[model samples]
Target: MAKSKRNVVTHGLSGLIGDLLVFRQRAGKTIVANRPKPSVKPPTTAMLKVRGMFRKAVIYATNIIQDLTRKAEYEKAAKNGQSAFNVAFADYLKGPEIEEDLSFANYTGQTGQKLVASIIDNFRVASVNFSIRDAGGDLIESGEAEQSEDGLDWVYTTTVDNPSFAGGVVIVKAYDQPGNETLVQVMV
Candidate 1:
């Protein structure tokens, strides 16, 4: 790949020149590269699935770009040389991620005990849900968590008191703006 800087012929030029080279603009700079060749072999099942997923991401990005408010939000989050559509498409392809394991050290089967979780997403995390289950797999409590002021952590206050929470399980599900969910389970 080569960068075209102030060249008379390639300056501000984009698209394919003949069948040999492809020119494009990025971050106010012109890029020159060889034309990519099409694959001759048939796509495998996994490749087809990935293609389908990318198609869905394209559709999602198109919808986001159509909405003025949502497009502005994504545009604000976009970095240099990145467009709103690019950020939205990448966010749709990737779900929310749990930054760390759930900490139950403060949760001692007492009412009003708080459980905190750290989560992150490419765009924005919409919500976090907390669920507790006993040793027998019976649900003890479930509710939505509140986002912290700094926007990095989610806090959930326990409502019910379960003295036998030692062998229980804590489940946390984090959701991104695109409704993609990431779940994590930890033994209490």
Candidate 2:
């Protein structure tokens, strides 16, 4: 009776019309138009593609920094070695002047061996000490070696090896071994 002046509309038409109406309300209460809830699921294939690009960029940046740091360390060591070499060469040109003091450092070695070194002059070597222990941190073996110049190229200050633990930690003491010393180069 109240709608006699207006055309009757279907429910579907009313819904369609309601969608177009902005800020609509019913009676005294607010009429919020129904909307599709946003998905809370994981990213879709398209989203993953975008994320993967960013991820790869991050990895590349990290590796670049790591490589640069390693190069810097090598360069510093080379500079030191070169200076020492120049001084030694000048002495050699003058012909063995009173056996000047010399030192070696950054020694690294494999398992099960004692350090051995024999040189004309008294000196000390820097060493890389490896300690393999049980869960309780009890030292299984300690290994060390000495390098002449760069830490990468070295001679086993200790000459002891076993077939059982060829690659494990070994402990050795620096001693004068009157014969050939095993030469070793640390791998990158």
Model 2, C-alpha of 152: deviation from truth (Å): 4.5
Clashes of each: 0, 14
Q: If scored against the real structure, what TM-score would every candidate get? A: 0.84, 0.18
- Highest-scoring model, TM-score: 1
Q: After superposing candidate 1, which stretches have Cα over 4 Å from the reference?
A: 1-15, 22-34
RMSD of candidates 1 onward, in order: 3.4, 25.9
For candidate 2, lDDT tens digit of each residue in 28-137? 33333554456799899999986775565455434433566633432343444453323222222221111122222322333434333332212122333333333333
User: What lDDT is obtained when candidate 2 is compared to the true structure?
Assistant: 0.35
Judge candidate 1 against the unseen true structure and give its global Cα lDDT, from 0 to 1. Answer: 0.92
- Residue 156, candidate 2: how far off, in angstroms? 3.0
> What is candidate 1's lDDT per residue for 1-188, written digit by digit as tens?
54445788777889998989998988878888899999999999999999999999999999999999999999999999999999999999999999664568767898899899989999999999999999999999999999999889999999998999998999999999888999998899
lDDT values of the candidates? 0.92, 0.35
